[model samples]
Target: MANKLSQLDQVFAALADPTRRAIVMRLCAGEASVGELADPFAMALPSFMKHIHVLETSGLVQSEKSGRVRTCRLSPDALLGAEDWFQQQRAIWEARLDRFEAYVMKLKKEKEQAAAKRPSRTARKKGS
Candidate 1:
C-alpha cells in the first residue's frame, strides 16, 4: 500500500543518518529525556533536535514534553515493517538460489553422464 511504502521510506531515510540511528539505538534500552539522549553526541542541542524530528516523523519514535524537558521513546513496532520486508526478500532469494543450485546439479550430472558415454583419448588413439 502507498501508506506502508511511505512509512518505510520515512523510516529508511531517518535511519540513513548515523546520528538519528544512534538516537534510535539509545532509545532501544529505554525512554530518556532529550537532554540525556543528546549528552553523548557532540552536536548542538538544536542540531540534535533535527535528528529527533526525523525519527518522530518516521514513526519510529515518540516524544512527550513534561515541563521544560522532552522525553523520547521507541514506538512499539518501530522496525516491524522493515523486518517483515527483509524476511520476505530473504525467502524469495533463498528460493531462487535453491532452484539455481538444483539446475546446476542437474547440469553437472548430465555432463558427467555424457562424458561417461564418450570414448577416452587413449581408447580413441588406440582405435586410430
Candidate 2:
C-alpha cells in the first residue's frame, strides 16, 4: 500500500501541470506525434517535449521515435497503482459507513421496542 501511494503521488504530481494534463487528455482520444501534441500549446517544440518527458518519466505515457517523428501513447498500466490506492480508501470508507448505518438501525429498533413497552393511559386508568 505504501508503494502504491508513492506511485499515485508520482502520477498525480506529474499531472499537476496544465501541459501534462492537456497531453494526457489528448492521448485519451488517440496517440499523437510530438509535433501534433505541441501544435495547440503555442510553445516551442523543445519546451513541449519537456512536458512529454515528464509524463513518460512518471510512467503515464510512452513514446517511440520512428524516422524523424516521435509518437506518444497513454499507458493504461500507469493508472493501476492509483486505482488500487483509491480502492483501498473506498473500501475503508464504505466499511465505516456500513457500521454507522447498522448502529443507527439498531438504535431505531431499540427506540421502537422501548416505546412498545410503555403502558398506555388506558392501561394505567384500568389499573387504577
Candidate 3:
C-alpha cells in the first residue's frame, strides 16, 4: 500500500506540470524520438529533457537509446493505479452521500409526523 501510494505520488507529481502533461499527451498517440518530442517546446533541449526524465522516473514513460536518438513510449497501464484510487474515492463519497440523503429523508418524515400531530392555528383560535 505504501509503495502504491508512493508511486501514485510520483505519477501525480510528474503530471503536475503542463509541460510534462503535454508530453504524456503526445506520447499517447505513439512513441517519438527525443528530438521530435523536444521540437514543439520553446525551452532548451536540456530543460525539455528534464521533463522527460521526470516522466521516465514516474514510470509513465520509457525510453530507449538507438544510434543517436532516444525514443520514448508511454508505459503500459501507467495510469491504472491513479484511476483505481480515484474510483475508490468516488465510491466512498457516493456512499456517504447516499447515507446523508437517507438521514435527511428520515428527518423530513419525522418533522411531517410531528406537524400532523400538532393542532393548527385555526383550531387553536377556535378553542380560544
Per-candidate TM equals 0.92, 0.80, 0.91
Best by TM-score: 1
Candidate 1 clashing pairs?
none
Candidates ranked by TM-score? 1, 3, 2
Backbone clashes in model 3, listed as residue pairs: none
Top candidate by lDDT: 3
Candidate 2 Cα outliers beyond 4 Å, as residue runs = 1-4, 121-128
Where model 1 places Cα greater than 4 Å from the true spot, the runs are 125-128
Evaluate all candidate structures by whole-model CA lDDT and list the values in order.
0.93, 0.91, 0.95
User: Each candidate's root-mean-square deviation in Å?
Assistant: 1.3, 2.6, 1.4
The digit string of per-residue lDDT tens for model 3 on 1-128 reads 99999999999999999999999999999999999999999999999999999999999999999999999999958799999999999999999999999999999999999999999999999999
TM-score of 1: 0.92
What tens-digit string does per-residue lDDT give for candidate 1 at 12-71? Answer: 999999988888889889999999999999989989899999999999999999999999
lDDT of 2 by residue, 29-79 (tens): 999999999999888888988899889988999999999999999997998
Ranked by lDDT from best down, the candidates are 3, 1, 2
Clashes of 1: 0
